[model samples]
Target: MKMVFRWYGTGNDTVTLKQIKQIPGVEGIVWALHDMPAGEEWPMDKILTYKEQADAYGLHLEVVESVNVHEDIKLGLPSRDAYIDNYKKTIEKLATVGVKTICYNFMPVFDWVRTELFKELEDGSTALFYEKAKVDSMDPGELVNRIANELDFTMPGWEPERLKLLAPLFEQYKQVSAEDLWRNLQYFLEQIIPTAERHGIQMAIHPDDPPWPIFGLPRIINSRESIRRLLQLVDSPCNGVTLCSGSLGANPDNDIVAMVHEFKGRIPFAHIRNVRVYDNGDFIETSHRTSDGTVDIAGIVRAYHETGFTGYARPDHGRHIWDEPCRPGYGLYDRALGIMYLWGVWDSMRAGEVAKRA
Candidate 1:
């Protein structure tokens, strides 16, 4: 597996590219142009600026976190064709910078939902937390405000532009069922997947944050069966899954290791993280260590090794440690620690394989 780190650009992030380079095995940065809004084509100069910055640090700028899919496309509006064309142009430009995979989601309102950004645990180090009861009981508008209030930087999915249109977006989605969303997604894939194929880039669709519907939104990309169906939608090597352990792991039913084995060549990017899940349906992001969370980090790494996975892998969200003020889940310390843990797992597995072969 090729290890990569998620670096929010120059001024937007607390972690610097130099710090990222210090991590032993981090081969690249999973990056994006965060300032640009959805449906707008990214400028070529901006894309090359990121490439130059990563090159300065000897890091590859191959995996982009997201290129936001406009709600018009998800709504399958008459204007969706125009947005899809914009998406195609963005893909072609990213290809110019040698970006191999573009990680994005199709959630209607929020990209990911969490009730608390710094929910303190018994250990004193805080992490992103989800309280199921809070999400179910709270008004979404209030929830968005609460989340925005906690962040110094704008949260990606909860952008003010999208949030301002929430009421109308919900009204638009009122007529869209899960099936309609699937059809719209298929339409999107049909239009853009061919372009992605021609450019040699993989369109890695991130699974729904919690792998379930929230605030009455129909979330279709939530399970193993949904993944299977998604692959059938475009039926091309270019159309693929991002396979995030924490997101899909929110649902206990998802067999992440099995997905590693089953989706073998179809997965181009993997977001490896752990979460401590409770019986009441709430979860907290935990360190990448296997014992710290419910997800089996060791087993997942082993499966990847067995499948001969050489695609990009990243240590996903991490805890806020050392009292460092950083993005809620994108902190540097814990994520760097997570990378060490992942490297340990991967190295041990490699040693075991060598011993067996000998």
Candidate 2:
């Protein structure tokens, strides 16, 4: 596994590239042009600016966390063709800057959701939390307000521009079912995968945040079976998965390790993190340690090792520790710690391999 860190870019993030480089084994940053709206072509100058900054710190800015998909594309609207054209252009621009992977998601309305951003754990560290009962009963407006009020930075999925069109977007999806969503995703992959293959960039689709349908939204990338179906959609190496553990682990039924082993060649990126699930079907993000949460971090690492995975991997959501006051889940302290934890596992696995060779 090639370890990378998620750096939200200078000024936009509290963590600096200098700090990220200090983390042992982290060789790259998973980044994107966060300021650019979806369906717009990313400026080449801006892309080079980020590349220069990361290079200054001796880090690669190759894997972007997301290139946000416009709602038009997900809805399969007539205007989607125009937006998709913009997306293809952006892909070409990224390829020019040596980007190896672009992680995007097809979930409509929201990218990820949590009822509380800083739900305090018993240990005093806080994490992104989702209360199932509260979310189930939440008024959309109230939920939006709660999320908007808590975040200091503009949350990726809850952009104000997109929220303004929420009602209409929901209306657009009123007749759209799970099957329709799948068809729309397939349509999207068909248009973009060939371009991605030509550019030598893999389009890694991130799974739905909770790996389940939320608030009547039809989430397609939630399970291993769904992932298999997705691979069949484009049937190309360029069409791949990000293999996020925190997202898929929310659903207890997802066998993440097995999926890693099964989809080895097709997985070009991974977001490895842990979450503690409650009895009531709620969950909160936790440290990368196996004992700290439900997801088996060590087992997942071993599976990746077994598969000889040389793809880019990064630590996902982390607790807000040391009163650092960083992005809700993208804090530097815990994520840096998570990297060391992952590296320890990878190192041990490599040492074992060396010993066996001897």
Candidate 3:
């Protein structure tokens, strides 16, 4: 696997490219133009700027975390066609800069949801926490304000401009159902997959953060079966899945190993992280070590090795350890540590295979 790191960009992130370069085995950065809003075509000049920065550090900008799907596209509004055309344009532009995979999600209101950004763990380090009861009881507006205002930087999904009028967005989604979402997603794929293929890029859909509906919003890409259906939507190699472990691991029923084996060639990018699930249906992010969380991170890496995966993979969200004042889940210390742990497991497995052949 080709390990990578996520960098928000200059000035917007606390972690610098210099620091990311120090991390062993990280060859690239998973990035996007955060200041650019969804549905609009990304500026080529701005895209070139980012490319120049990554080039300075000798880091390949091959994987983009998201070119976010617009609310209009998700709501299946009349304006969706225009937005989709813009998406196609963006895909073509990204291809010119050598981006191999684009990770986007179809979740309606939020990209990822968490009740607490810094819930103290038993070990004193804090991590992103999701409380099921709290999410169910809290008003969407209140929740949005709490998350949007608490962070120093703009959170990926909870863009201030998008959540400024929550009620209207929710109302727009009221007309959309799970089936409608699937149809709209299929339409989107049919439109963009050809563009992605023509440009030598794969469109990988990130599964819903919690793999479940929240605030009555429909989340379709949560389970193994749903992902299977998604692949069949376009029946093309350009159509793919991000295969996030922490997102689908929240459900506990998702067989991530099976997914790796089944979708071997299709998964062009992966977000490997661990989360400890509670009996009460809440979860907290943990280190990548197998014992630290419920997710079989070691097994998952072995699965990739067994399948001869050479795709781009990154250590996903990590705990806010060492008093690091970084993005909620995108901290430096723990993620770097997670990368070391992943390399340990992956390298050992490869060595064992060599021994067997000998």
Candidate 4:
């Protein structure tokens, strides 16, 4: 696994590139132009600037977390063609910067949903929490306000610009079902995968966080079977999955190890994180240690190793440990700690393999 870190960018993030470089085994940054809104083609100069910054710190800018597929594209509106055209242009520019993978999601209203950003854990360190009851009972508008008010920085998916159109977006989505989403997603893949193939960039779709529909919104890209169906949509290497552990792990039914083996060559990026789920259906992000959460992170890494995965992987989200006031899930201390834990697991496996050969 070629380990990477998620750096929001200069000024937008509390963690600096200097700090990221200090983390052992991290060779690249998973980044994007967060300031740029959806559907707009990213400027070449801006893309170059990020490239320059990563180069300065000896970090490769090969994996972009998202290009933020526009709502129009997900909604399958007539204007989607224009946005998709722009997406193709953005893909071309990112390819210029040597970006190997572009991670985007097709979740309709929100990229990911959490009821609490700092839900205190038993150990006193806090982490992103998802309360199923709260999500089911709360109004979508109210949930937006609660989440927005808590964040010092604009959360990626909960952008004010997009949330402003929430009512109409919800109304529009009311007309869209799971089948409709699958068809629209297929349309998107068919349109863009050829361009991605030509540019040598893997277009990875991140699975829906919580792996379930929320606020009456249809979520299709969550389950293992659904993922298999997704791969069949375009049937090209460029069309792929991000293989996020925490997102798909919420379902518990998703055999992540099986996915590692099954989707072997197609996954170009992996988000390795842990979450502890309760019988009540609430979950809180935990340290990357396998014991700390329900996810079999070590097993997942083992599977990756066994499959000869050399793709870009990152410690996805982390707890608010050491009183470090950082992005809700994207903190320095815990994520760095997570990286070490991952390395320990992976390296031990390597050592075991060498011993067997000997």
lDDT of each: 0.93, 0.91, 0.93, 0.93
Stretches of candidate 4 exceeding 4 Å from the true structure: none
User: Model 3 over residues 259-329: C-alpha lDDT tens digits?
Assistant: 99999999999899999998989999999998999999999999999999999999999999999999899
Candidates 2 and 4 compared: the better one by lDDT is 4
- CA displacement after TM-score superposition, residue 178 of candidate 4 (Å): 0.5
Off by over 4 Å in 2: none
Name the weakest run of 10 consecutive residues (lDDT summed) in model 1.
151-160
lDDT of 4 by residue, 1-358 (tens): 9999999988889999999999999999999999889999999999999999999999999999889999988888899999999999999999988999999999998999999999998999999999999999999999898999988875789888999999999999999999999999999999999999999999999999979999999999998899999999999989889999999999888899999999999899999999998888889899898898899999999999999999999999999988897989999999999999999999999999999999
What alpha-carbon RMSD in Å does predicted model 1 have with respect to the real structure? 0.8
Where does model 1 exceed 4 Å of error? none
Can you list the residue pairs that collide in candidate 2? none
Residues forming the 10-long window of minimal summed lDDT in candidate 3: 147-156
Candidate 1 displacement at residue 28 in angstroms: 0.7
Model 3, residue 282: distance off in Å is 0.5
Which whole-number lDDT from 0 to 100 does residue 118 have in model 4?
Answer: 94
Model 3 reaches what TM-score against the true structure?
0.99
229-304 per-residue lDDT for model 1 (tens digits): 9999999999999999999998888899999999999999999999999999999999999989999988999899
